[model samples]
Target chain A: MRQNIITRFVLISLAAGLLSACSPVRDIRFRAHYHDANDLLYAAAQESDLPYLKAHLKDGGIVLFSESWDVDMQKEIVTGDGQHFDFNRRFVRDGEMVVSVDSVVIFETNKMPKNNDQSRISSLSVLGGLNTALGIYCLAVPKACFGSCPTFYLDGDQEFHYARAEGFSNAIAPGLEYTDIDALNIYTTTGGTFPLTMKNEAYETHNVRSLKLLAVPREEDQRVYHTQDDKFYLARQRVELTSARSGNDDVTYLLNKDDQTEYFSLADPDNLRSTEEVFLQFDNPGNIQQLGLVAGFRQSLMTTYLLYNAFDHMGNLYGDLLATVSIAEDDAPTIADVLYEQLGGISAYLRNSHKNEWVYQGTWYETGPIAINHQLMLLDAAHPEEEIHIKLEMNRGMWRLDYLHLTEIIEKVVPLEIQAERVYANKKHDEDLLQIMLDGDAYLVSQPGDTYRFEFELPAIHDDYELFLSATGFYMVWGREEWQKEKDLYSLYMMRHHPGRYLKKHAQAYKEYEKVMEEAFWGSRVKHQIISGHDK
Target chain B: MINKQVLLVLLMLLLAVSCSVPRGLPAPEELPYETKGTAFYVKLHDGSVYRGELIAAENDALYVLPAENQHPNMKRQSGVVQIPWDAVDNYRVYYAHGKSLVWFVPVYTIVTFSHGWFAFLTMPFNLIATLTAHFTSQHEHVLRKKDIAPEELGLFARFPQGIPTDVALQDII
Candidate 1:
C-alpha cells in the first residue's frame, strides 16, 4: 500500500510539472508605482481591493495618472545578435522621464548543449550507454520531449523569440521541457533619448504582441561624489571617442600596437584647422565637477588649443566660461639655464635663443606630452543628475589624446598658508577681505544672514602658484536670496580663462559675465588680481 | 471511463487554459471613491485653494454647487460654480461611498467564464468577494501634491530654505 501511494504521488507531481511548463502570463499590464511604495505594488496588483488600488496607483504616485504618449514594440525580431529597436522617436518629447516596459516575451527558443558522440562513446559502458541513448532520443525526437521547444507559431510568425531560458534553482522533473528567455537577451539603447530602443540579437525573427508605457519615479538614493575629496570617479565611466559631426572625413579612432586607443591625427597635420569637432561621450554624465584632459604626443613648440562645449541629451547648452585648455608652447628646465648663465657657455646662449624659435618659426621635433585641466560646475544644486555632452573643437589638433579623466565634486580641504592683517564679519553687506588670511583654517559660525570676511597678503603675484579656496558656506553675488544653501558650500579660486591674460585686464567683460552667470547659473568663485609680466 | 494517461493530459490542458486568462482592471464600483454630494478640496498649482460641494463632474469641467460656508472670496456663477479641469491640480473627497454586493456579481461571473477551471479550484476565496458589495472600505483621502521633485530643479537654482536636508543636497561649488 505504501509503495502504491508513493507511485501515485510521483505521477501527480509529474502531471503538475508538465502543466506548468506550458502556462503563460499573457498581456500583463505594467503598472508604475512610486519607488517608495514599489515594495508592495506587485502583491497589491493581484487583489481586487479598491482601496489598495487607489492608494497605491491612482494618486500622484503612478505614471498613468499623468498624460503619456504611446509607443509600439518592434514587430519582427532580427535573426542576428545585433538587431536594434527604435525608441528614440517616441521619447523625443520628454527625455528626462523614466521608462516603463509592459510586455516580457513568453515563448522562446531553447539553447541545447552541443554533443560529441565519439567522446561520449568511450565513457559509456553497457548500462550507461543505454541510458545515454534514451536521453538523446527524448531530446532529439520532437514528439517524445512534449511541448517545450520554440516552435510555437501564432498568426504565421513565431509565438515568441527563440532563446534559452535562464535556469532557476528548482530542478525540472524527467520528460518535462522548459524554455529559457535569457538567451534572447533583449536590451534597449537610448542613444541620448528617453525610452531607449530594445535590441534583441538572437538568431530568429520572434513574434511580438502588445506593450504599454509608464514612467518610474526618480530613485531616492541617486547621487554623485564631489571631486573635492579627490575621490576617483573616472574609473566608473566607459569612454567612446568619435567625431562631433557625422561625416566620413571626421576624426578616426585607432588602436595602437600596445592595444591602447587614441584618435589618429589627420594625414595632413595642418588639417587641424578644419571645422571637424572631436566628441567625447561618457556614460552616466551627471554631477561632473571637473573634467581633466591630458594629451600625450611628440609636439614641442607648437601649442595645440582645444575648445570644449557642453550640451545635454536634449541639445541644451551649459555654462559661459565652462572650461578651456591649451598646451604650452615650451617646456624648459631651470638648472640648465642657471648653469649656462654662470659658465657663459654655448649651451646657455642656445637655450635662450632657440627656446621660442620653433614656437613662432616652426620645426619638426616639437612634439611631446602636455596636460591641462578645466573645471566647471555643470549641474545646479537642485538638478544634479543631468547628463553632460563634451564637444572638443580643435583650434590646432595635430596631437593625439591618450585618455580623458572626469572627476566628481566632493569636499577636500587644502590650506593656503597666506597671512592676513584683518578679518571682518558682517550681517548685511558684501565685504572684500583679501588682505589678512593667517594661512590657517578659518572658521565661520553665525546665523543665516551673517557674512564673514578675510584678507591675504602674498609676494608680488607672479602667477607661480595656483590659488584654491576651502569654505563651508556659499553666497550668491550681491546677496541674492534664491541662491542660498545653508551650511553646505564649496568654491575654487583659480585664474579665470581669458584668451591671453587672466580676468584682471578684462575686468569689465569679466564683471558682465559674472553678472549674467549670477542671474542665470552658479559655479566656483574666484578672486581677481592684476599680475605683471604674464599679462601678455 | 477514460484511461489514467488521458485523464492526466486533459487536466494539464485545463490548467494551461485557466492560467492564460488575462487579469484586467477593476470595475468602477469596485474602486474606492465617493460618488455623490461629496465635498472636494482642490489645490491649484499657483497656491490657490478651493473648497466646495461637487454637483456634477463632466470631462471638461466640474460643476460645484458652492457650499455657502466654503467659497467666501469668489463670486458664484449664477448659483453654481464651474471649475475647469486644467485649472485644478487634483481634488480630494471627504467621505467614502460603500458599494453593494450586486455590483460584484457581473465581475465574478465574467471571471468565472474566463477562467472557469481556476475559479472552481479557488471558489472558497472568491466567495468572500462575490458575497459582499463592500469588500473593503477606506476613509482616507487620496492626496497629490503639485510640486516638482528635487531632481527637476533648474541648473542654477538653489533651495533657499533647504527643503529636504535628509536627502543630500546637490552642491556643485
Candidate 2:
C-alpha cells in the first residue's frame, strides 16, 4: 500500500510540473522609482548649482562639464575603451539590472572659450563681462571695493601686467616677454588724457583705485606689463623715445615732431639747445626702472593736472600731446636736468601774453585732479609695519588720495631663528588679488558743494613714520562728529605698491602726489574708490 | 481532456522565456555620462583653445594628441591640445569613430497617436530617443570610484592676469 501511494504521488508531481510549464504567462514588471535625470541637469543650469547635479552623475559625468559646449548623446556612443557605435550596431543584453557608463568620446569641437579677448570674441554670451572684473578679483579677496580700491602694498615695482586663464591653474604664461600682436595679451585703461602709461614688468603690489578699460587681449599665454601708476588719482602720460638722449644734454624737444628743432624755451638761453634726454616724471612715486624702456628723463612736478592713458590696439603706450604753446627756444629747462631742479627756472605764460594765464607745457607730467578722488589700500603678505607706496587718482573735478600702503605678513610674525613652515592665509584657488585687490587712504576732495564727503576711515600712524598732509590741505576740514562713529569709513589709504618694512622715505613722494592732485582737480566729479573692510 | 494540465505547462514555458532579461537593454551600468557623439578639443602648437561637436573619435589616427601638449609652461597648469597626426603640435582630425546628435521629441507626441502605424512609427522614435538620451554625452557626469581623485578646476582657468602693480590692488589677509 505504501509503495503504491509513493508511486502515485510522484506521478502526480510530474504531471503538475508539465501542466504549469504549458500554461501561458501574464505580463510582469518590477518596482522602479521615477528618475528624471534631466531634472538634475536642469537644476544645475537653473541655479548654477554644480555640486548638486554632480552628486547624481557618476564616472564620466564630471568630465562632460569640461567637454565641448555642444552636449549631445543620441546618434552613437564612442566610449573611452576604444570602441565605436556605428549605424545598425548590435549590442547584447546581460541579465543584470545594474548599469554603468563604459566610456566617453571627447570630441574636439565646441569647447568653452578659455580666454575673453573682446576683439576676437564678438559673441557676447559667455564672455566675461567688464562687470565681473571687480567680482572676479573678489575671488582672491573677501570683499568688494567700496569708494576706492584699497592701497595694495607690494614688495616690488608697479605698472606690470600678468596673464590669467580659467580652469587652468597656471594663468601666468611661461614667456616673460609679450609676443604675438595678433593674440594681444596685454591691456590698459585711460584715466585723464595726457600721459600714457607703459606698465613696468617688475613684480610688485598695486593699489587699484580706478581703472579705465584699455584693451581686451585674445591670447591666454601672453606676457603682462606691471604698472606703478595709482589706479585712483591717475596721472596719464605717454612715453615716446624719439631719441632717448635728445632732451638730456645739449638736445632740444619740440612740440611738433615734424620740426624737431623748433622748440622755444625760457629757462636758460641754452635750455632747448642743451637737452640730453626727456624723462617722464609722475606725482605717484612708484618704480620706473622695471618698465623695460630705453633711457629717458624723469622728475616730480609741483602741480596737479588731468591726463588719461591710452595704449595702441597692440597694447603699446606712446606719449601724446594735449596742447602746446611756443616759447623762446632758449627759455625752457633742459630735458637732461631733473624736473624739480629746473621747474622754477622755467617760466610759464601763454605764448601770446605774459600774466599767470597758463596752459600746460607738452612736457611729460603726472596729471590728475586738483582735488583727490580715490583711496585704495594694500598690504604685504610678509610685513605690515613698514610703509610701502602711496598713490591717488583724479576724478570728476577733484583728486582723491588713493592709499597709504604697508607690508602684509601672512603669519604676522615669525620666530627669528626658527626654520618654520610658511603659513599661507589667503587660500582660494580661483582667487586673484589683481582681480579684487583693495587698500586704504584719505581723500580731502568732495564733489562741489557737498555733493560728496571725504574722511579717513582707517589709521596710518604707526609712530614709526611721520606722515604729513600739509601739502594736501593744512586746513583741517570738519565733521569730527562723524569720525568716532565710523572708524572704518573715515580712514585713509596711506601707501601702496611698495615694500612696507623700509624707512618712511619711500612713501614721501606719494604723500606729495596727493597734495598736488588735490589742487589739480578741486571740483571735478572725481571721487576716491574706498573699499569697505566689510566682507559679505 | 485539455484542462488544468495544459494551462500549467503553458505558463511554465512563458515565464522561463520572460525571465531571460530583467533590465531589457545592455549598457554600461556604472558610467555617469554617455557619448551621443565624438568630438575633440584642439590645443594649437601656439597656445589657444578650440573645440568641435560632431567630430569623430576612431582609428583615423589623423589628429590625436594628449592634453599636456601645447603650453611652454605646462607644469603650472598643463593643458591638453589636439594636433593632426602628421603635424607635430598643430593639426586637424578625421576619426573613424564619430559623434551623433540627440533629437528631442516632446511628450505631447504620445497623445498625437495611441495606435496604428502612426503610433508604430512614433513608437520606434520614442524607443530610440529613450535609448539615445540614456547614453548621450550631454547627460553624463562623474562618478568617483577610487579613493584618490584627480584635481578638477572650474571655469576661471580661461582668464589671463595682466594688471600693473601701482594700480593693481593688493588685498591680503
Candidate 3:
C-alpha cells in the first residue's frame, strides 16, 4: 500500500513538471500608430475612435483648458482660453492665445492591453502555492525526515537492511568523539585487497579521523564475536537451540539461523520501559569449560524514534543542547549515559538447577537499526547432565534478535589492524584523504553527498579470516529551517534531565510519526553511484 | 493505506494549485469610473516626464494635477499645470492593482531545503519562477500610450463625464 502511494506521488510530480515545462505564457500586445498629425486628427474626429480619444484626453497628455478651446486644421492654428504653459508643463500665464499646429511636435495616445498571459500567471501562482504548502508541511512535521551519520556499504548489498554499519551515531559533537567497531560478518574473501565504501548519505558533516579493518583469523567452523566491552573472542563447536519459547509460542525457527528473520515483541503501550523475556533450551556440550551464548540482534525503530524526538524537541536550540552535552562535567551523566539507562540493554541469565534460580550473566547492546550486531555473552559453568537453559530479557519492542546459539570458547584473540593504503573519493584517487585516514591526526571532512572508497591491503589471501570495521569520527547534524520556529529550551532540559518522563509524555506523539517514518527515511536516501573495481 | 507524509504533500499541492490563479481585472466598461481616479506618466516633447492625476482635457490642451511630492521641480507649485497640445508626447496610465508577490521568495527558498540533495535544482527553479512572476505582473498592468488612445482613457478618470467646470482647481488638487 505504501509503495503504491509513493508510485502515484512520483507519477503526479513528473506529470506536473512536464506540463510546466511544455506550457508557455501567451503573449498579448496593445499597440497604436498614426501616419502624421493630420491622420491622428482625422482619426480622433471619428465617433468610432471616441474611447481611445477619451482615454488619451483623460491622462494621455492632451492639454485641457479651463475655458473653451478650438482647433482649426485648415488654418493650422489652435486657440484656447486657459493658462498657458511652457514645454515642461510649467504655467506661463492665463490668457487667450492662438498656437500653430506646426508647433505640435507629436500627438500620442494609449490603450490598456488585454492580459492574454494567463498561462504564465497561472503557472507561477500554482508553483508559488505548492512551494508555500510544502514549506508549511515541513514546519509542522520535521521529524518525518531522516538524518544520520556516514553509512558504510559492502559491494552488491542492496537496500537499507544490507547497510554494514553507521559511524559514530552517539557522537553528535566533537567532545564526545569515539571509535566505533562493527563486525562486517564477511568471513571469507578471495581478493588480496578489501574495499569498503563509505557514504555520507545524510544532511550532516562527517569529520572522520580514521578508518581501518580489524581482521581476526579463525578456522572453517570457528567464528569471531565481540562483546559489549569491545573484547574479541573466537568460538567453535556451535550448538543450535533445542527449543525457544516467548510467552508459550515456540520461536526456535526464528532464532535458529542468521537469515534476517528476526523475533520481536511490541512495547507495553502504558510504559515504554517494560521488559520481556524469551526462554531457550540448548543441549549441554559435555565437559565444555568455556561456553558462550552468541546472539545476533539489532535495535528496533524505538531507539531511532526516541533519538529523533529528542532532536526535534531541541529544535533551533540543538546547538546549545549539544554544547551542554559536550562540555558536561566528568561526574555528570552525558546524553549517552542518560539514554542507555532509560532503555536498558539485553540481559541474559543461566538457569541453575542446583540453586533453583536464574543467574545473571551480562547485558550487551549496540546502537543502529540497519546492521544486525552479534555479541557473545559468556555463560557460567553448568552441569553436563543438566539442560543448558538460558533466559534472554530485554526492553519490549526495543530489540530484534535474529540468531542464537551456544558455542565453546577457544581463547581470547586480538585482531590484526589493517589500515587503508589508498582512498578514492567519487571514483578519483585522493591522497590527502588517504593520508588523513592513515595519520589519524586530522579529519577527512565529508559533506552530504560525498562517497569515499577505502582499499586495505590484506596480510594474506587466506579465506580463514573474519573482517570487522573500526571507524572513529564525529558528525554534526544540519538544523532545519522549520526547526527554528520550534525552539523550546525547557523541553530540551526535560529531555536531558528526565528522559523517562520525557519518553512517557512523548509516546503518543512518537506513535503518530513512527508508522511511516521508516519508509520515508529509507525513501529519502542519497543515491550513490557504484564505483567499478571495488571488491565485495 | 497511504503514508501520512505522502498525504500531506498531496493535500498541500492541491491547496496550492487551487489558489494559484488570481482573479482577473474587471472589463473596461464594467469598471466603476465615478470614484476611481486615473494617474498617468506623461512624457513631454523635451524629454521631461511628469506623473499625476488627470484633471480635465480640451481640444488643444490638457489640465493635470501634478504630483508635487514625486517631482522636485513641481514641488514649488501646488496647482494644476496646463500643457499645450504642441508640447505633448506619449504617456502611460497606471491601473495595475495587486499585492506584491515577493513573499514567495522566502516561501520557495524554505521549501527548497525540504528536497534533500535535490535542493540544488529546486532552488534555482523557484527563484526564477518567483522573479519572473513579480516582474511580469508589474508589466502586465500598466497601459502604454502606443497601445491605447487618450480619448478612451477619459472613461477611467474620476469623472468620466469630464471634469466639472464649476469645481475649483484647488479643490480638485
Candidate 4:
C-alpha cells in the first residue's frame, strides 16, 4: 500500500537525519586555544636519538607514599596486581641524537577540555614586594579524582562580581572601592580553581562574617556519589557545591573553622567578569569562559603544521585571529570578613609536536586501543613508584570531600569491558601472564584469549588479594588523531556492578603492530625535525 | 709600458664609462618569470597568512624568519617566531626586487619588540650597519628555478601592491 511505503520512507529519513546530526562537519582551525589543547607531550632521551621512550602506567601500579602529605599514590592505583611499563627506547633512526620518553598517564586527573561557562573573577590590590601569580583552574570532570579546579582572584583593589546564583544580578562587596577599576584578571598556563580560601573585606553592621564569595563550575556541574551506609563514597575527594537559590541571586558557602555547618556563599553580579574586565563576550552564555591563555614563543613544527600551518620568516605572510573571554563564578559562599578568596595558580606551554590525527584516523590504530578504547588517558610517562603531581591551577574553591573512598575497595581490579588484553612486554621477553582475582576466589582472567565479564560474589571473603592471567603484551590508548568524539552510550569505562579480573591473548602481529605503532608514534616527530630543518 | 699621458687617458675613459653606468640598479635580465603558489607561510599561534618569494629562512620558535634583503646571501637573521593568532594584525607579502620594509626583520623580534633589549648603546651600531647596507649594497636579485611561475603570473602584475617583493610576490600574502 502507498501508506506502508510512506511509513517506511519516514522511518528511513528520520534515521538518516539522526545519524547526520550526530557528527557535524567539524571545523578545527588554528586558534590560541590550540596552543594548549595540543597537550600530547614528548620526552625525548636527553642522551639518545631515539626520539621518545614510550612507557605506560599499569592497571595496578606500585604504591607510592607522599612523605609530605602521608598519602599514597601507588596504593591508590593498586587494585589487584600492580602493573606498570617503561619503554627505554622507541626510535633508532636519529643515530642516538634524539631522546624519547615513556608516557605515563596520571589517572583520574583533570582531563576536562576548555569550555564555556559563567565566570567569577577577583580583583586584588598590589602591596609592595609581594610575589603573587594568578592560578590556572580547569573546570573538572565531575565525580573524578579532583572534581574541578578553582578560578583564582587576580591583582587589584576593586569590587568584583559574577553570576554565581541561579540567575544574573549585579553585586559588589563592601570596602572594595577603586578610583580606576582597571579590571585586573588572573592568568595561568593550565587554568583552574582553588581548594581552600580565607578573605578580608569591610563588613556591614551585621558582623565581620557577612562577606561571601561565589564561583561557578567551569565545565559541567558536579554529580554527588554516596555510599550504601549513609556515607559519601567516591573514587577521589572533591569540593562539592550545594545550593538553594532565588531569582538573579546566589548563595556563597563560607567555611567557619569555628562552625562547619554555618557555611553561606554570596551570589553577586558585581563580581561577574565582563568586557569591562576581560574585554570579550560570548555569542552564547553557555560557552566555557576563556580565562586562561597559552603564551608560547617556541613550539614544534608538526603540532602547528598539522593543525593548519607553519610560517617561515622569509615565506612572506601576514594575517591572524584571536578569541578571548572571562570565566563565570557559579557557587557563592558567604564571606564573613574577607572580600575575596583566592583558589589556585595558572600557567601554559607549547607541545612543539603534532598529533597525527589525519594519518592514523579510521585505521585499526584509531580506536586508541583496539579492543577497549581508553576514555580516560593519563599524561605522565616513566612513572616511578613515586607520587607525581598532576598539577592543576584554577580560581574556584576546591572540590571538598566530607568522607571518601568507600567504593575504592579492591587492591587490584580490572575494567569489566575491553575485548583483548593484548599486552606485549617489549623489554623482557619473559613470562607473559596477567594476574587477576575475584571475590576471594583466585582465578586467571586469561593467558591468551578474549576477556569476558563474570559475576562473582563471595560472602565469606573479607579481602581478596591476588589472581593471575596471561598476556603476551599489555594494552594501550593513544590521544592523537580524532579518536571518536563523545563516548558510546554502551561503552564500558569502569566496572559497573562489581570488580573482577579480565584476560585475553594478544596476537603475535599485535605485538609487532605495537612495536610498529610505537615506531609510528615516534617516527612522526623525526619527520617533523627533518622537514623543519633546512627551511626554504 | 706606454707613455704616462696614454695611461692617464685610459684611466679617465674608464672612469667616465663607470659613471655612465647606473649604479645600484636592478638587473634587467632578471629572467622575467612567475612562481608556483604552493604552501603559504603563516605565523604560528596567531594564524596570520602570507605568501611571497621564500628568499631566505632561519628557524625560530615554530615559524621561519624572512629577510627583506633582496640579496639572499647577505640576509642575516635570528631564529625567532610569534604565533600570528597571538598578534593583532597581518602583513601582505609584497616586495619590489627585494625585501619589504616590514619583513626585513624577523617577526619574532618585531612581535616581542626584543630588538629594544639590544640597548641604546648597541642601537647605533645596528643603525649604522643597516644604513651602510642600504647605501652601498647591490640589491637586484635573481629568482630561483623553483620560484618561477608554473602558471602565468601575469595577472599578479596588475594588482596594486603593499610591500613590493621579488617578482614572485602576489598583491596579498
Candidate 5:
C-alpha cells in the first residue's frame, strides 16, 4: 500500500509537469506608427513621395473609399464620397466631401499586432503548472511539511539526521521552558573560536533565552556521558558487543554505529505496551569496580504520532490545554508524564552467572524523534570474569537503537561552561541580543526561517575535551489549518484523564497515518545553507 | 537511484535556464507587413481620435478603413475615410512585444516547494532573478510622428500596393 501511494504521487507530479509544458495563452503584439498633419501634407505635396495611407475624416461624417474620389496634387485638394461627424467623432452624413491638403492634422495606424513569441509563453506555462501542483500537495498533506524546534549543526555536517543538537523539544509552552544538553560527540578541538549554527527551519516559533557550550575535559580513548539524573561521567575501555539478538534475529551490525542506520521494529498489533527484549554479550574487561553501559538511541514515530493525535483531538482547544499545563505546579502530573509512563522506556538488566538470573540495572528514556539522544546506564556492583551479558527490554516498536557499548567508568566530572561571546541573528551580528542571552532574562524570539549563529571562545585548556550544547528555550507549534476541522474534545479528555484507555482506543487511527506521516515528515526535512562569512 | 534523481533535476534546471532568455521585439524591417494589417490611431487638430487600417495614399490625400462605424444607422455611407494633409494633427503606430511578468508568482511558488526547508534562502534569490528578467525585457514600442516619415507608415497599410480598382473595401479589411 505504501509503495502504491508513493507511485501515485510520482505519477501525479509527472502529469503536472507535462501539462505545464503547454502554453495557456497566446502572446499579443501591436505595431504602431505616427505622423503629424504637417508631415502628411509635406509628404503629400511631394510627387515622388506620396505617402500610402489609410485615412479617416471626422468633420462630422464618415468617409468611404469610392472609385470616383480623386486627389489633385497641384491644387492640394481631395474630393471623395464620405460621411461627416461632430467633433465627438460621431458620424453625420455620407456625401461628396472636399478637403484641402493643409487642413489635415494627424494620420496614424491602429493595427493590432499578431502573436509572435512562443518560447516565452512555454516557459511561463511550465513554471505556473509546477507551482500549482506543489500548492495542491501542501494543502493535501500539511502534516508532512517540515516542522520542529531549533536545530543545531556543527561546521561540517549538513544532513538533517546528523544534527548535533535539537533544543527544548519538550518545551511546548512558555511556562514549560527548560534547558536541554546534548553531547556534540566531538572529543577534541583546537581550542579557539567555536561556531555553532542554530536554525528555526520549522513552522514553530522558538524563544531562545540562552545558549552555551558545556566542555568536559577527558583523556584520549575516553568518552563523556550524562545520566538521567544529569550526572556527567568519564568512561574508558569501551567494548563492542560480541553478539546482539532481538528474539531470533542478530542485529549486532545495525547497532554498531552512531549513524542514522537504526534498528527498529513494528509495534505490537494487539497491544502498544507489549514488551520485547534484546539480549547482548560483550567480552568482559576483567573485574572492573565501576561500569557504565552507553546507549545512543531515540524514539520512533510512535511517540510523535501519539503527540500529533493528541494535538489533533485538542484542535481548537489546543491553546487552552497548553495554558493549563503551563500554569500547573512543578510537581503536578501532566499529560506528558502520563503518556511516558504508559508506554514505558528501555530497561537494562545484567545476568548474574552464579545465580543464572537477570538483575535490574537501570533505564534511560527521552522523548523526541529528531535527534538521537545518548545516556549512560550505570550497573550496580556487577563484576563479570568471562563475559558481560546484558538485556535491554523496551516496548515493541517504541524505540530505535543506533549505538550501544559497555564502558568502564573512570569518574564523575563537572562540565566547564562557556557562554556565547557573540550572536548572529540571520547572519547579522546583534550585540544587544548577545547581551540578552548572557543576561538569561530576555528571549531572542525566532520566527520561521530565522537562523542564529552562536560563537563561543573555547576554554584555555590544552587537553582534549568533549563538547555539549546547552540551550534553554521553548517553542510554540503553529496550529495547522487542517487540524481545526478534526476537533474532538472528548478524545482529548480521554487522553488526559485516562491515557491507558486512550492508547488502546487510538491505536487503530495511528496505524492508518503512521506510514504516510513518517514518509512525509522525513522527506520534508528543511535544508539550510551556511554562508562562509557571517555577512549574508 | 540518487544519481538518477539528481540528473533529472539538473536536466529540468537546464531546460528552465535555456528558455528563460527575454525575447526581443522584431525590428521594423523584419515586421511582417504582407500577412498582417498595421493599426493606426489618428488624432485630428480638433482633438477627435480615430483608429483604423490605412487603405491607400494618392494625390496628397489619405484613404482609410475606420475600425468601427460611429453611426451604424446612417444611410448612404461610404466604407472608407478620406483625410487631406491639412486636417491631421499627429498619429502614432506601435508594436507590442509579447512578454508578461505574471508568470513570476507561480514560478517562485514552485521554486519554494522544490527547495523545501531551504526556501527561505532561495526565495529571495528567485525574486531578484525574476525582477531582473522583467525589467530587462522589452514590452512594447511606439513610433510617434517624428519617429518615422508618413510615407514609411504607408508600407503597413491594408493595400500597400494601392487599392485594386475592382475590389471592395469590405473584401480586403
Candidate 6:
C-alpha cells in the first residue's frame, strides 16, 4: 500500500507539470532572442512608441501580433456570405508559425455610415395635399427619378422596381476578408500552425466551407425566406439542383450564389403588401410526401428602430411591425399567412441632425434557423402533373430569406457539435474598480456578442484624470437605459481617441479636438440623465 | 436557509463592488444656488501654468479659456488651453463669486417656478449645498496641492504667492 501511494503521488506531480508546460502563458524574458532574464526589454521603449499588444504584454502570456494597411473603401462592396477572400500579400520574413495565437490587423476604411436623410416633403402622407404639392415641385425642379432610381428586371419575365439600390453596393474582391482589426475577436487556436484549414463534411459529397478554419463540423448556415398571404401560389423554374443527391425521393436543390452551395431560396415579391404576389415553379417529381423549410431569423431592436424610421421622419413606433409567410398550390385556395413577428431589422441613423453624427446600434440574434416540415401528400396523393406555387409577403416588418424545400423523405436530423470560435472578452468590476482596471487580468468571454473589455495600468499622475480607451469596433457606445431590453453585455467606453498610429499627429490639433470630446461626453451624459428620469 | 445565506452574501459583495466605480459629478440643481463661476488652475507636463475660467471638463482633457480681464501677471495668451489629462501634473479648482445675485436670483426664480411648486421646498438644501461648495472649494484645493512636487510646479513656481491681487475677483458665471 505504501509503495502504491508513492507511485501515485509521483504520477500526479508529473501530470501537473505537463499541464503547466502546455499552458499558452510563457515568460517574455524567455523570448528566443533575449539573453538576460533580469533586463526589462520594454524599459527603453516610450509609452507612445509601444504598440498596444507590446505595451500590454503580460509577464507570462502570448502577445497578439498587430499590423495595419490602408484599405480604399470608396464604393467598396462586401459579399454577404462570410468567407475569407485572399489578401495575396507576400511576406518576406520566413519563420515557422508556432501556435497561431490571437492576431489584430486593423484596416482604415474611413467610410461614413449610410445616410438615411430624405426630403422633408416626402414624409407627408400620400393622401395629404402637401404630398401632391411636393410632387409637383419635384417634377418642376428636376426629374424625381433622374439617376436616383432605375427600372430593372428580376428574370426575363418579371419586372422588379426599387426606390434606390436596395443597400450600399460596395463589393469586396474574391479572396479578401475584412477583420476590422479595431474590433478583433480574441481567439485561442488549439495548438496549430498558421492558416490551418477546417472543412465540415456533413454529407458524403456535400462539404461546407466556413470562414474560420477548424478541425470540427461547421454550424448550419442561416437560410433566409419570404412569403405571401394564404393562397396557393406557384412559379415555373423556382429551383434547380446544382448537384444531385445520392437518393432520389422527389427532392431537388437550389444553389446559393453567395456561398456557391446548394439551397432553396424562395421567390421574393420585393414589395411586402397584400396586393403584391410572388410565385415559384418546380417540375413535379413523383410521389411527394412532405415539404421542408430551413428558415433563418435574427432581430436587433436598435436596427429595427433605425430601419423602421428610415423612410419617415417619425412615422410609426413599435406598432409598425407585422410579417408572414404565405404558401399555396396552383390557385387551389390560400393558406393563412404564417405570422413571423420575431424577425429583426437594421438601419444607420444620425443621433443629431448633423449628417456626420450617425451612430449605429443594433442586436443580432443567435437562435439558429429551424427546419419545419409540412404534410404534402395528405392534400392530394397523385397531383404530379399540377405545378406547385409558393408566395411570401409581409405587412410592415423586415426579415431575410432562408430557404424553401420540397421533399418526400423525412429523417431525424442529428445535431452536430458546433464550437463557437469567436468571443468578446469582457471583465466585470470587483470591490475596487480602479484596482480591477489596473490588474489587466480578469475578463469574461462572450460569443455572438459585441461587447469587449480591456484593462490597462493607471498612470501615477499628480492630478486625477481619465484616459480614453480607443479601439475600432462599433464606434458609438449605447447607454444602459437605451439598451435595457438587450440582455447581452454593454461595452464600457471612455472619451473617443484617435487610432494608434495617428495619436501623435492628432495631439498636435489637441486644442480644437478637446471641444469635440467635451461635447460628446456631455451629450452622452445628458441623454442618459434624461432617459433615466433624472432630467435635472 | 443555507442557499439564502449564500445569496445574501453574494448580494452584499455585488453592492460593495458596484459602489467602488466612481459616479462622476452630482446632478445639476433645479434652482441655481451656485452664485459663482467655476475657476480652474492647471500645470502641464511641459511646465506651463493656466489659470482662468473653466470652459469644459471631459475624460480626455480639461479646457480653460483664459479669463478676459485679470491681473496683468495672471493673464495668459488668448486661446483655450487643452491640457490632456495624461499630461497634467497638478490642477486646482474653486468657485469665484463675481456679480452673484444679479442674474442668479432672477434665473433661479424663473426655473424653480417652471419646475412646479414642490421645487420651492428644496431651495433651502440647494442653498446650503451651494454655500458649502463655495466656502470649502479653495480650502480643498490647498490640501490637494500638497501632492504636487516642486519640480512639477512649472510656471506656478514663479508665482509663490496666490493669484495676483491687482484685479478685483468676482464670480459671475
Among all candidates shown, the one with the greatest TM-score: 5
- Tens digits of per-residue lDDT for model 5, B126-162: 4433443332232234455776567766555544434
Q: Is the docking of candidate 3 incorrect, acceptable, medium or high quality?
A: incorrect
lDDT of 4: 0.19
TM per prediction: 0.17, 0.17, 0.56, 0.13, 0.60, 0.19
Complex DockQ per candidate: 0.02, 0.01, 0.08, 0.01, 0.06, 0.01
Q: Model 6: runs farther than 4 Å from truth?
A: A1-275, A294-303, A306-385, A402-408, A416-477, A480-536, B1-173
What interface RMSD does candidate 5 have? 11.9
**What is the alpha-carbon lDDT of model 3 when measured against the actual structure?**
0.66
Superior by DockQ: candidate 2 or candidate 6: 2
RMSD of 5: 15.0
The deviation in Å at residue A48 for candidate 6 is: 57
- Can you give the lDDT of residue A364 in candidate 5? 80
- RMSD of each candidate? 36.3, 34.9, 16.3, 39.1, 15.0, 34.7
Over the stretch B1-173, how does candidate 1's per-residue lDDT look in tens digits?
22345446445533432422112212223222211233455666666677654444545665554456555777754555656767877665432232222344344434442221123222322332233112221111112222222221110011111112232212111
Report the lDDT tens digits of candidate 6 across residue range B1-173: 43355456445533433322112211222101121124556777878777665544545655565555543465333345556778887775432211111232233333333221122222322232222222222132221345433332221111112122331122112
For model 3, what TM-score does chain A reach?
0.70
Over A116-184, each residue of candidate 5 has an lDDT whose tens digit, in order, gives: 234444544554564455455444334234546788898766445667788887788988899888878
Each candidate: chain B TM-score: 0.35, 0.19, 0.63, 0.20, 0.51, 0.34
lDDT for B69 in candidate 3 is 69
Scored by DockQ, the top model is 3
Candidate 5 regions off by >4 Å? Answer: A1-144, A519-536, B1-12, B15-173
State the TM-score for model 5.
0.60
Worst 10 residues of 6 chain A by lDDT: A162-171
lDDT string, candidate 4, A1-536, tens digits: 23224544764564343333222121111011101101321211122331111112222111111111111233332122122211111221311111111212221111111211111000001100010110000011100111011111222211111101110000112222111111011111122221111111111111111111221111122212211111211122122223212122221222111111221111111221111100111111112211111110111111111111111110122111100001224332322111112211111111111331211101000100001110111112221222211221211111111111001111112311111222212222212222232112222222211212222222222221111111111111111121223222221111111111100111232223222222222222111111101111
Error of 6 at A264 (Å): 17
Give candidate 3's error at residue A249 in angstroms: 2.9
- Candidate 2 ranges with C-alpha deviation above 4 Å: A1-397, A402-536, B1-140, B143-173
User: How many Å off is the CA of A63 in candidate 5?
Assistant: 39
Which segments of candidate 3 are over 4 A away from where they belong?
Answer: A1-147, A518-536, B1-173
